[model samples]
Target: MKTITTAVAALFALSTAVAADEVCMNASEMQSSLIDWYGERPVEGPSANNTRLWVSDATGSWTLVRTTDEGKACVAAQGRNWNASMDASDVLSEIAENTES
Candidate 1:
């Protein structure tokens, strides 16, 4: 019984590690998604004429800027919370890919 429990524990740990590793998006996918989402906007600061969409994930964070003030205003109105340690860009990219495909 003790041996079975130990085996189960080890299996659980391995599964958890695998899940973490597969959490989501690769770098290129992330960059692509951001580019698609931002459209024609220049990726930089959140200016009055540019809307900034910021995202975070397990690895890091990224921002997508929109060229038109109207777009910026729309995102600002939505009030998304962009405060995660991981790479949210990757997560979003993964989600987009999954949903689209």
Candidate 2:
């Protein structure tokens, strides 16, 4: 789990350094896409400007999304092996550490 988290964090950090291919849509459409296509549902929300975490227990897949002031939702990060028992703050701290390195 820690390895997956670190890998995800590293990927996310590298993604930020490069030009991201962000897909944006109206909040409704984004929600439907996550549910229908990925079977992910919102489990966390409104952090740092309307950010939310969606997870699919069936597949252990997860996605982080953020909504803009215009109400458009965009995918920020996505990966697998999402453990509901894990603390979000811990994952975020891992991300911060990975980014710093």
Q: What is the C-alpha local distance difference test score of each model?
A: 0.35, 0.69
Candidate 1: regions farther than 4 A off:
1-32, 35-47, 69-101
Model 1 per-residue lDDT at 53? 42
Q: How close is candidate 1 to the true structure, as a TM-score?
A: 0.22
Which pairs in model 2 have colliding backbones?
none
**Residues 1-101, model 2: lDDT tens digits:** 78666655644544332117887899999999999999988876667657787878787777778799998998766767566565565555454455453
lDDT by residue (tens digit), candidate 1, 1-101? 46544433332232211222332344344446655763222223544534344443322233433344232222211112233322333333332343342
Residue range with the least summed lDDT across 10 consecutive positions in model 1 = 71-80
Q: Give the clash count for model 1.
A: 8
TM-scores for all predictions: 0.22, 0.70
**Model 1 Cα shift for residue 35 (angstroms):** 9.5
